[model samples]
Target: MKSEVALLQYSDASLKPPLSPLFIHNDPSSNIEDHPSLSNLNITQQQEQVQQFLKDDWLPITESRNGNAYYAAFHILNSNIGFQLLMLPPAFLTLGWAWASVCLLSAFVWQLYTIFLLVKLHESVPGIRHSRYLFLAITAFGKRLGKVATLFPVIYLSGGTCVMLIITGGGTMKLLFNTLCENKFNAHSLSGAQWFLVFTCVAILIAQLPNLNSMAAISFIGAVTAISYCTLFWTLSVKKGKASGLSYTTSLSKDHSAVAKITDILNAIGTIVLAFRGHNVLLEIQGTLPSNLKETSKETMRRGVTISYILIAMCIFPLAIIGFWAYGNQIHGGLLTAFPLFHRHQITKFSMGAIYVLIIIHCLSSYQVYAMLVFDNLEIKYTSIKNKRCPRLMRTCFRVLFGGLTLFIAVTFPFLPSLSTLLGGMTLVPITYAYPCFMWLAINKPCAKGVVWWFNFALGCLGLLLAALLVVAAVRTLAITGLKANFFKP
Candidate 1:
């Protein structure tokens, strides 16, 4: 098979001018003989060097590539907006509205900075252009260390996230069933494990939909559902606050000990970090951009990041403030769960039901977004088919098996909140915060005394520290509560 550079060379002859002229040597007018690097090479060696340079500098231009800014924005929105958004209310309960907002904004800026670093690194390093996270790691850190850094985190994040999605989807399905059935079918009648199996089957079907671009419609709907449910949640929480006559308060509870408060605040920070953790798949989304269009990739990334931040700020702050004002310490895992008081109202029940449906849909769609990453990696590693698409039968069988594995894991460990926090600290912190900064530092080699270099270095250290603390906090919480091994337990 020809290298991507070779393919681009072929296409360049037929379509547009070569991308080499745009990136090669950063001096188009300078003769190859004038450049010290190429001047020493013979003609054949010089030609090969130029080809290698082009391959390193730009992603291959494909005629079939069709994504634009809107699709890219929706892709980010779908990936970022998941069941965790609903957990913002509980996060706010721990941190209070003021501190929660501050943390949320800080996380947003931190994520944006890291994302910019990753994109700039991709552009700056010729060898890593259009590469996945793993390849980027290998290019920067060498094979052994790169595989160690990339494989474990990517698997842990993608695979663990898929399992969490199953748990959340199953739990939400159970809630909807109980509500609609009027308690006729309680937790005993249909177990959460069984519902997980059911959703896993559903995801198995969705997983066979081919590729990421094919799921754009589902992603668009998922984004809309996320926005709608977040709006409805904020509205209901505000209504509850008005009825309860409690003002939005930023004060921490005096009843809790200082240690407990600090732990809760750290847990809240972990949850927020998890909510913002979609950087793992940014490169995949970036790949969808038309490779020939100059700056389109960067612009698409900017638009997507802007849209995500705006939506997060709009949804999270209001829900946090109102939900905390109304429920205080009573708030639990999700804002939706904090609606028991309003359940008596028909409108509230209807809204909750709709929100549950939306959550289920969001989970299903977002599951594919992450699961695809895992599938792609696995297929490349295990399958005989390389360069060409995997056969339909092989794809279906692989997905079915993968789905079963995820289902088993979800049933075995059904603790969504704790699992999410663990994944955030262990997988997401590195992927979102540390790795990009480290990669930028390695690839760009910014000035030692420059602000950018020190800023990223500080952020990397902070990310490591934050991950360690959050992991410790999550483990401690689990130990104190004792692990619930019974899958049938309500």
Candidate 2:
């Protein structure tokens, strides 16, 4: 058994393709006999072990049976781009443009590299090529470490994201109601908790949709709204800054203490981490590509990541720069909230209303992108249903129950930004950055002195440290501000 595990590890190292855009159609299994450690094993026995391994870890999806590149791209965009972009401006406010840009760029590159690591690891593991993130962890780190390090983070991150979506969706709804019905209904009367419940019902309805592929149109709409609101927010920020003559300098305020500044910087890092928190779903999206071609999955992920990076570059940088420039220390939790309400022109009011509407649409659609993952994980554990067919009654009950639980959490702690910071800082590190690198090191066992080995090791360590610090900072911030009142408070 030990020898068999070692052989699997050797195959992973020997078979992984170099990082490149071009795909080579070579099978790694053909070279297993070349390993010196496995010389004593007969070819028939070796083949049998490999076959058994494949059977034991069979993935529901396969390379030969997957969706196309376009669908995959849309899925990636939907998963990556969401309400998180709204926080980028505030992150910029914390770190200033120079450091903020550096963090953003570094995060973009690092996330892409970690994603490639996950892809290569998936390719190296036979019978688990189309497996989910949790399976990949089990394949690399064993069941114990997999459960502790990978499974928990993936589950928490997915479920926590759903909670955040509920808060954001409800908050946006409340904002829209106040702005649109300024004269009729009192926004203060309709508590945030109520709005959250309203949005939870909407999410449960949408969550009833069948599968990930069924959400392609929804994802596409989400992607569009994400880009649109980000663009609009930046435009408004720039206009507001110019009218008010706000400074664009990267100077710290005289009133802020050193500790406060440090806290702010950590908060910004946490928010940026959250903004790039889509690596958890990369494999699921990749599974959507057509499996007929040997290079389809690789090419699909590459194209999708490339498009997402392009969108992020266009949206995040400007929003961060202009938002900070406009509001500086005065900036609120979100850029849209910083916009002045009183004495606004009718066109401005209409545009703001439109942006809020887009936010609602975006959040509702994006909610399913994450909720589907939670549902899949839950159904796998609880339901006896097989082959993607659960009884309609069972499925409905699960969705409502899960949705209700998330709604309850959101109502209890309706502090959107603080919760987002905590969730990102607490879970994203392992899910997005650390686990992929650790899995690669475990499976490949690259030369200890080699650059690649040290690079991954460093990234894994850095991710853990960063996550810890961000969690501390976020918790401190939450304690200082106190939780939002459950219902409504003036």
Candidate 3:
């Protein structure tokens, strides 16, 4: 116990975890020395078990733990930045300037604080690593309740993000096909469902690249595309200057009814909440880094997040703030769709085509990072039940099937703008904001109603209540939009 306390004191502050009861005891399977009463045969068996445990990483997200902070940043950017970055402008238009700015900045700070908490909790146990979010929740809330609470939410949060990616990526491809081959493309062009399949095919091909670490190069390109498109779109918008009749007055789907207006605001908040996601996979990225007595992986992840977030700030704020200024309420769908019409005389086919291509590439890379957790979770169960490594080809088949399902959902829906925000409100708010805070409280057990405890409690409660309202708002919005649109249209 003294040694454990000393180790706790020695850990880096950013990685420091409150000493939990779980960390005080050694795993019976791994700590053979603690069981002095074991027979010689039993001792030999325990030794073999330890060897097997060490031979196969308890978590198989990576083949090895040799990744650096740079690779970690790419994973962060790939998952964090996407088509949603473009939505910030519309969210601002929906909420108005002052309220929207405050929400964005506050949400950013709040989620960053929570992510730091997640980083600390990753390796809270001295000889154990909570390399998966579900395991971390189980450790905090105990297995039964934790699984019930977190299992489906994590899958829906992560998987739903992939579904959105498929929608956006496929739509962008269709746009590019139409724009680049404007004269002859419509005759031979595929339907929105077919385009979604094309994107899913690319994603499944990328998923076959073995482990999370193997996607580093693709993540790099994805991250670059994120920055490139953000810069190009915002810069072009600025060059075109502000529109002649720019107004920042917010509206709710052309309805002025009190209920409609309130629902629109709630959905906008959901959009912002969804934008800050990627914390679900935070520990997984850190798991790829080697940890030892002298140093910890949390600090490495902290560095990576700091750098990636700085770049994220660069991309999102300029694009969103300037985009809102340039287009105001005219911003619909995204800057991409609104841009060509708003600046048709000044804009070229090359500019619109370039943005579409970048968006498609970004979606392909981003899908893998978000879907990586889904793949790992599936593998975790397979290995546990089979008591061996999962066969590679079998794993590949599972990914293809998962991709197909999300594609089906993406193509079946008419692709309303409200859907992603609806999903964000339903699943992401708790997974990103509320659950982590509660898990920290469960593990840390800070003084009741004191500063630390109260702070987290307030945030968790806020997330829950906010999610409830957002759901009401999102459902209302979806019903209104669905009534006006056809099924199976993008």
> In terms of lDDT, which candidate is strongest?
3
What is candidate 3's CA lDDT for residue 462? 90
- True-vs-predicted CA distance for residue 406, candidate 1, Å: 0.9
Residue range with the least summed lDDT across 10 consecutive positions in model 1: 12-21
- Location of the lowest summed lDDT over 10 successive residues in candidate 2: 15-24
Report the C-alpha lDDT of model 2 over 172-245, residue by residue, as the tens digit: 88888877886476834577788888889988998887677777788888888888988887776665444354
Clash pairs (backbone) in predicted model 3 = none
Cα shift from native, residue 364, model 3 (Å):
0.7
**Which candidate do you rate higher for TM-score, 2 or 3?**
3
C-alpha-based local distance difference test score of model 1: 0.68
Ranking by TM-score: 3, 1, 2
**Of models 1 and 2, which has the larger TM-score?**
1
Model 2, residue 366: what's the lDDT? 79
lDDT at position 341, candidate 2: 41
Q: TM-score of each candidate?
A: 0.82, 0.81, 0.88
> In candidate 2, which residue ranges exceed 4 Å CA deviation?
1-65, 187-190, 239-245, 249-257, 292-296, 340-343, 383-389, 479-490
Task: List the RMSD of every prediction in angstroms.
Answer: 6.7, 7.2, 5.7
> What digit string (tens of lDDT, one per residue) describes model 1 on residues 371-433?
877766655543222423456677677778889988888887776555667667888888898
- lDDT by candidate, in order shown: 0.68, 0.68, 0.76
Task: Quote model 2's TM-score.
Answer: 0.81
